[model samples]
Target: MSPVPNARVLFNAIPQGVPTPGQTTVYDSSQSIDLESHPLNGGFLIKTLVLSIDPGMRTRMRSTEEKSYATAFEIGQPLEGFGIGVVLRSENPDVAVGKYLQGRGFLHQQYFVLPSLPFGMFFLDRHPALPLTTYVGALGLPGKTAWAGWKDYSRAKKGETVFVPSGASAVGTMVIQLAKLDGLKIIASAGSEEKVEFLRKLGVDVAFNYKTVDTRGVLEREGPIHIYWDSVGGETFNAALDNAAVGARFMECGQMTTLNSVGSHAITIENPMAIFGKSVSIHFITSFLIIPKHLEEFNRVVPAALVAGTLLRSPEDVRHGLECVGEMIRAVQSGETRGKAVVVLGEA
Candidate 1:
């Protein structure tokens, strides 16, 4: 195959007034993506198979910075995010061809090249014991996100009860398993009964269907969840706030509400007074903030957890072919799909 131009999906404009599928614009290997044939400058080609479609992308697409964590995507340019791919070609000795890698600012595309950047690093050095896709799930960002939420922000301890919202989603799944490994009693909430059952199979002490289970009441019934991992930020967050025990730690992790275009009203946690009264701390966790100093920590701890049979990677939901990228993303966005939504470009 000759090195032809590459094509990728780009965001046309931030959807401010209405939600239209047209907001995403796709292109064939020409716009904002880097195109270089040489690795002289630490550039490498990636064949993206499974592009991650996440809820946080909703907040990223908005124009507001009041509650956003990362840089907003540039209009008419290819949007960037974490995606799993194979190194098709590499100029840098550190990154070799045919190796599996995970990168940020990666998108729903087939083949693209990028310069070495923080978002462009982190290659999987052939963990023969695990499936290649595990890098995108259990051993990847979602795994790190779950680990940080539990280990750093929540400070979850053995035998303590931990509540995780969006339990069937990517990060939620990892949170459940990691918390379980830590000997914390795991309680989770998923949007559907089927999802709740899925969590139960994962060894959750309690799993509730978010739609019908009166999540706040359920949490109260469960009693004293030491750490509340809020993955679904609107009502579910409010529910967590109501159900938290005194001195409970609340970790603000994600906003699944943004995906539904929920109103931008101020959400005041009554628990703040309760939090202050009980000396509780609310911490925000972002996997991106796991600094270079902490990268070694994650690189060491997470893999060990997987190898030791502590953290488990569930079945991945893969969309075959590059052209199906948009449809795959829609499946995730519409909540019609569960687990890690990805596209496979080729073999590792």
Candidate 2:
């Protein structure tokens, strides 16, 4: 066997702020591997097709001392995330050659060997209705996170108003759909006009560009927000607290506004009293907590909804090639990615 290209995205530096391509992350295409001769142990080799670049991953790209739900990415090592791929060779019978699999912590490489299908890796049976990309996105962690939050944390009720900030994102879009389905009025916000338009397309009761409008004023005018499905947790989080109605529920999923501050600093709530005085309940939600409890139900219901078009796969900013992996990371951390930032590593 001869060595062929096996390039991967590497963690080049620990960012003090918003990570930059080449600075924080670097695409290294110089590496190569002998596919047939590479040690697989009892696992297999996979050819990656698509990878999901999530906002939460920014937390992982930090120093170990900083800490996060997931372990920090090591500098000068291949970075990892969720992706779907086709098995190229196998030593494990549970997974077979040519079968598609969705994996957690997949090295961001064109091709690599998996030790085994551990906790978050499994073979996926190809269904024409359920695209592989969605397996890493809307129907993936973001979808599961949205479903779990709505099911267990949203505390939503019919006719109540919910404010969904970051409303055009993967989780945001899914949450909006779920809230609308359950008869909630959605007051959603996004940074760009395009995202606001997308929220409107999802039939949000009120959608606006938070960058230009008076966010607090709008919240005070239209709300008494019954539920705040917050992913962007800097200014919007405080605004949600200020305009929150009595006994409002806050489903705290992500904080993109503070993503870059993981190692250096933290954000404080502007009005802490609103949470206490308003009798608001805050629930921190994560896919890790939810997946164990609801994986079966999520797998059963989500795929069907996505296939039936009741739950549209969240909009994606799909890019091609491993070269753009760093670019994707930059966009996701900087909050410029319009949707779920995904990288097409190869044709599935």
What is the C-alpha RMSD, rounded to one decimal, of candidate 1? 3.6
Q: What are the per-residue Cα lDDT tens digits for candidate 1 across 173-237?
A: 88788787789988887766777778988899988887787877887788667888876676767
Clashing pairs in 2: none
Error at 196, model 2, angstroms: 1.7
Question: For model 2, how does the per-residue alpha-carbon lDDT over 1-348 read when each residue is reduced to its tens digit?
Answer: 889998899899887777788899898989898988888999899998998888888778777897577999998898888988898999989888999888686889999887778678777866697757888878778877888889887777899999988888888888999999999989998878988888899999899988899889999899999899888788888888889899999888888777666553566778887578888888888678776787888887878888888887667799999999888888887778878899997876
Please provide TM-scores, in order, for all candidate models, with all chains considered together: 0.83, 0.95
**Each model's number of backbone clashes?**
12, 0
Give the best candidate by TM-score.
Answer: 2
Best lDDT goes to which candidate? Answer: 2
